[model samples]
Target: MILGRSAISMAIGIWSIVEQAVAQHASNNRAKGAPITKNVSMTRAVYTKLLREKVFPAIRKKWPGRKTTTIMVQQDNAGPHVQDDNADILEAGQEGGWDIQMVSQPPRSPDMNVLDLGFFLFVAVATIQDTFDTDGLIAAVKSSFAKVSYHTLEKCF
Candidate 1:
């Protein structure tokens, strides 16, 4: 991988959107009468569901041009997102007759290192202070993401 500014500032398009789901079961504190739906962990099953039910559909609906274009979905080293999603994505892409592939992003890019992601860290910590519960946290994060514009992302690079 290149270690320069050019490597960090490539043409960017947001493909996968953030997904947050409520747990099927009640909170662990339910026995103490604090019952509430909790945010589910990012497990393989959950990621798979998001890819099949939400992401792919969204891509199909809003893709800029050519529905048959080869789409490369990039994800970080997150195990659930990269591990089996390759095979699963291949099969799903075939069923829909779309050329979709999941690619594991390199471990690091010079421009978007820890310093660039400081924007996210700041937003997360800033919003956490105003949130009181898991639901609030999720909402706050989603709101933060929604507010991010191309300008905001450009600053990161």
Candidate 2:
């Protein structure tokens, strides 16, 4: 899930859940060897596209009346996340004369991330109560994200 926060408001930018699929082969009515599972982890390219295509647009739509055009995006310190100098992200931020900056969270500080400590927990609880397949799980998680209150997110700060 992607979220935007400021002094006055907090909004969910993008919430997505992807499933990993495994390829299995049957041999003589028995399973043949181990299944090959495709990696579903987020990569730098995917994150960059998310920032450019999803987060930025949400920021613009949600905060069009804000006084400042500069938006600072705080991201977790993950290997797939983009650096501050990513060319595509920088260019996207510069669209419509807005300044967009990517900021990394401090190392070894899980509590510092609002999403990890708060929103994700809510989602996990909401999802855990339901019995759903992969597609259903994704839908339920997205619905749970929408159900989260902005006040709850604000309290995470």
Candidate 3:
């Protein structure tokens, strides 16, 4: 889900994903550069489902008999968000007998995480180009996101 706020002079979009990508650039002195766009990879329910379906399956497929492998869960330092959703994933991993580790992100450090900056800039560029039509926006977003590999993202920022 996307939560947005647009008033006289500011626009902000926040996604359900615990991780956030933020980008800021200037078009003019007085005008806000651009509305910050947010991307959420997986929500709690979705993330849980992915753990049950995709992650577990991939792990089992790789090492069928062996029950242990190092698994890492990386997340930003948001207490409420982590408590609400991420904790469940951690608990489920333990119950499933998977050796899992949790990596808490440093607070207020979007730059430390590449995905945040990269993904946000990609979305912003796509949205700006796509302001005309809904379908066009989707296509643009998809194209931009697809191109957001390490090299492309670096060039964008």
Q: Which is the leading candidate under lDDT? A: 2
Q: Model 2: residues >4 Å from true position, as ranges?
A: 1-9, 17-39
Give lDDT tens digits, candidate 3, residues 1-157: 1101111111112213333233465554323544344544555565566555555455545545545655554556644334423566667656557654445667787554655665677779778772653445656766765665545534433
TM-score rank order: 2, 1, 3
lDDT of 2 by residue, 1-157 (tens): 4444654446545545254544477655336563433335688877787787888888887778752667777777889988888888888988887786777778778566765677778778878866444555666667777888877777777
Compute the lDDT for candidate 1: 0.55
By the lDDT metric, which is better: model 1 or model 3?
Answer: 1
TM-score-superior candidate, 1 or 2: 2
Clash pairs for candidate 2? none
lDDT of 2 at 14: 51
How do the candidates rank by lDDT, highest first?
A: 2, 1, 3
Error of 3 at 43 (Å): 7.0
- Write down the worst ten-residue block by lDDT for model 2: 30-39
Would you estimate the TM-scores of all the predictions? 0.65, 0.76, 0.45
* Two-way lDDT contest, 2 vs 3, winner: 2
lDDT of 2: 0.69
lDDT of 2 at 153: 76
Candidate 3: which stretches are off by over 4 Å? 1-68, 83-87, 94-98, 131-139, 150-157
Q: Judge candidate 3 at residue 9 and give its lDDT.
A: 12
